[model samples]
Target chain A: MPNIKELEDLTTQVRRDILRMVHKVNSGHPGGSLGCAEFFVSLYQEIMDRNEGFDMDGKGEDLFFLSNGHISPVYYSVLARSGYFSVDELNTFRLIDSRLQGHPTTHEGLPGIRIASGSLGQGMSVAIGAAQAKKLNNDDHLVYSLHGDGELQEGQNWEAIMYASAKKVDNLISAIDLNGQQIDGSTDDVLPMGSIKGKFEAFGWTVIDIEEGNNIEAVLKGMAEAKSLTGKGKPVCVLLHTIMGNGVDFMMHTHAWHGKAPNDEQLEIGLNQNAETLGDY
Target chain B: MKTYTYKEKKDTRSGFGAGLAELGRTNPNVVALCADLIGSLKMNQFIDENPERFFQIGIAEANMMGIAAGLTIGGKIPFTGTFANFSTGRVYDQIRQSIAYSGKNVKICASHAGLTLGEDGATHQILEDIGLMKMLPGMVVINPCDYNQTKAATIAIAEHDGPVYLRFGRPSVPIFTPADQKFEIGKAIQLTEGTDVTIVATGHLVWEALEASKALHEAGISAEVINIHTIKPLDDKAILDSVAKTGCIVTAEEHNHLGGLGESVARVLAQHRPTPQEFVATNDTFGESGTPAQLMDKYGLNSAAIEKAVKKVLKRK
Candidate 1:
């Protein structure tokens, strides 16, 4: 397990990467990516039992799929730092001929991505399917997935949630970045996903709550508990309560920053909050 | 002209089921997923025979599409079974991102396509599926004519890589195509040879085309009948060669005239070798609840309509 200081440093670096990548492209989702930085760092550094060299099927190692692919900054950062690719490639995000598209895709022959999931509500089902595949292959590795809170409004996510529980996809762990904010406004004001934990429990999932998803230690403990609940004949769902922009003070608790990149001055302020623990890409 | 015989009449969905069962026995990598439509899709035999390889995903077509895409990651060939309406339109984005765009080796098996879905009405019958699927890049669109052809196509798609849409129907139709005929992806089958007009058709319309050819032969028109099972990656050479001799074409299908097999053929002909063509298909109207025969007659997807279309195209030429 990584110490809190190391995980915190990793989170800072990921936040820096997210801001830098989104700023460079001038078009990408950065708020949710910044919020989910700690969770991703903890997963890669401690939680998941993944192989260093990537495999498409993830045969003998744990697998993760980003259902909320808009948070590609956090995903790509963690993936690169976890040794999937060089960290320098992070600069080419959303650029022409870059593997890191505006939305996460497997079409560019990225090693870590098994399925393309820029379109919302499809990732949970894909993750469930991957979990079922692991069972059929007799590989005991677990399948992990993450989705945004606003994405729950999509009918396909409900379909997937119903299926994962009904089909007893116990070898899976799904998380919701319950940031309560979308591109428009708060989730309550936009579509209102009321009682998300109760919703999953009602769908027959083993639900757990992480009160501070932005905190590395809390996120790690919540994920560990989620892993333990797996293999017990029920799918596990973690409702991660996180701030939209966790590191940068000025960007937090606002919907304006959900998709918009920071200006020159705001970028400098954001960079200062997240010091480059690992060298900046 | 050689006449065809139907020993038994069967639903094309049953052909898909039989093909899936056979595939299970032949290839260990082949897996099946049903969104609570195993019986409707005629996939019970495969499920019963290979219980471990089959998954009952309830009434979640979107989730089923995603799962089918994920199953391909481990090199497993997955066949997702659902109604034509749910298979293409309901879960289009899932199919687009996970299967087509991602380039997963998934066979989207859709049953009860077009007006043949019968009494369930316009809500159930899907006339735009062929167009929707064909529009996607790298997607193979297939609409087999009979039980034997559907079975052959099912087995053939498993061997080919990338995404494929295998469309079948619910009602029992004539089983005319030979069981021993080998199935090719983009090849059109020449059922009869003639000199005056070319009759091109797909799905349930192939039997109609055959009947139309017989009727035209009696009237001294000698119309050639071609079965175009594969709509996208169309058999241009066969169509152009036949049109070169015939000089006119009549396309028929159990779907809307717009974006159906007729339009696809017309596009090919217009680009390569332009020929006068007439379409015997449903107009831009929704299907109503009725018997399969009633719907076919109401939509003008019948032998008489095909025959009339052939004469009309020939007259224009």
Candidate 2:
């Protein structure tokens, strides 16, 4: 039910924002941000039934939490584009006195962020708690969260995962970014969690696998399917298979760009790849 | 000094349970989460009354802390129940990032704190929980004495709008405070007035402080007694005014000499009054297996210890 053309345009702008924001500071985790641009754009623009104005208590609306907070550039850009804050503030990403922290946090009173999450593996438990709250309120709304593939290594996620299914937290959707890369190396090199989909299935989540996570239509189709699977008896998990850096040529398929920013020449090349779709923030 | 008496004795954890049950009946927004040890936490009545509001997190303290933070997003005031050791040290990062730094209205109701949580020994008995909790900014740390006051503090924190670390213990100490007393955070209750050394105490030591005041009065010392329930956002006016009259202080608690209520009071006195003080607490050592009463006496956390501290600090005065 979305205009595919506009979603693509929004994704392009988000990619540009990710590059420019990180490039300005000569720092940030651009690999994950670029890879998650489409997911962020689709969630904010099409998927979530949200209010025009932001409230700390997101009561009556479908809530989305980015568990993999290093991808905050994409999250912030999409939030700005979707009218959470001024798009011009994207320039202050990771700067002093700015709400746009390198990782998403509510400590700065950022409107879109509900909790601080630079530290990995905490978002899942928080999301599950939100889902439980929705059930307590009889709100009939869904809670969605996105986590990095590498972040699954944290022991706390398993504790939360086991709890969600055991409690029948059926109104929640947790999507894992299956980019297979981390800061030090690929997930396999760091600490391999074999068969990520099978792992979630064993933990009792209804699994949805999207092979092309970077493609806007594929992600939309996958997410819609995920929303349909909710409210049954178990929490849902989406195995989003994506390249580390999808938009740019040099950064793709490598863990080297995990937390590094692009240089001036590399920035120009990245910008040339994604045209000015909705104008750079 | 004026004498006080209690008809019975009760654990502060039971007070928390009573307050939680009251909240369940009154405030529909209140929710309870426990990481195991529900019986130890004395949360059976609340869980039984409001099964939907109760969350059994099953030994995952970190996840419980995180979920408590998340529950605040949808306007549910979550109270996480666990032992003080696990509540403060084990899931510190989860609380730091999710609740404290984010400033969520989650009540971390920790039971079984300090040497009084005996039989389980040092692993379960956390002497430094007050210090660990009070160090976090925007975290309102409270260690109420007696069953009545803990219950009042529990009910009061639910009405407060920020993160609160509500600390209580397992042992059944004397319950002297009025059952219907209006509990105020950061406001010290003046138990007995005097002009000699100020005897400020918290947790299980408050009753000991009262007893010390009585003995000191009999010995003609005229000792002052104050109940410092809330450690952070401390009752500075009461402490400063009392110290202005008394000139020196003897701080006591069922905790360590470092980073506990004794140190918090010391910081305030050092900055303002510059009064000499003696601490009646565990001397930076771990507790061993013993009865609560035995441990209290061994670690200098009793009426006699408070009496000795009062006498020592009066010499400096």
Model 2 deviation from native, Cα RMSD in Å? 1.0
Query: What are the models' TM-scores?
Result: 0.98, 0.99
Clashing pairs in 1: none
* Model 1 Cα lDDT, one tens digit per residue, B136-158: 99999999999999999999999
The parts of candidate 2 lying over 4 Å away from their true place are none
The most accurate candidate by DockQ is 2
Question: Each prediction's Cα lDDT score?
Answer: 0.91, 0.92
List of chain A TM-scores, every candidate: 0.98, 0.99
Candidate 1 Cα outliers beyond 4 Å, as residue runs? none
**lDDT of each residue in B76-178, candidate 2, tens digit only:** 9999999999999998889888999889999999999998889989999998888889999899999999999999999999999999999999999899999
Residue pairs that clash (backbone atoms under 3 angstroms), model 2 = none
**Interface RMSD for candidate number 2?**
0.6
Lowest-sum lDDT 10-residue window in model 2 chain B: B308-317
For residues A67-166, could you state the per-residue lDDT of candidate 2 as single tens digits? 8888888899999999989999998999999999988888888888898888899999999999999999888989999999999999899999999999
Worst 10 residues of 1 chain B by lDDT: B1-10
Query: Candidate 1 lDDT, tens digit per residue, A1-281?
Result: 46799778888999999999998878899899999998899888898898878778788888898988889989999989889888988988999999988888888976677778778888888888889888989989898899999999999899888888988999999999999999889999999777988899999999999999998889999999999999999999999999998899988988888999998888999998878898998
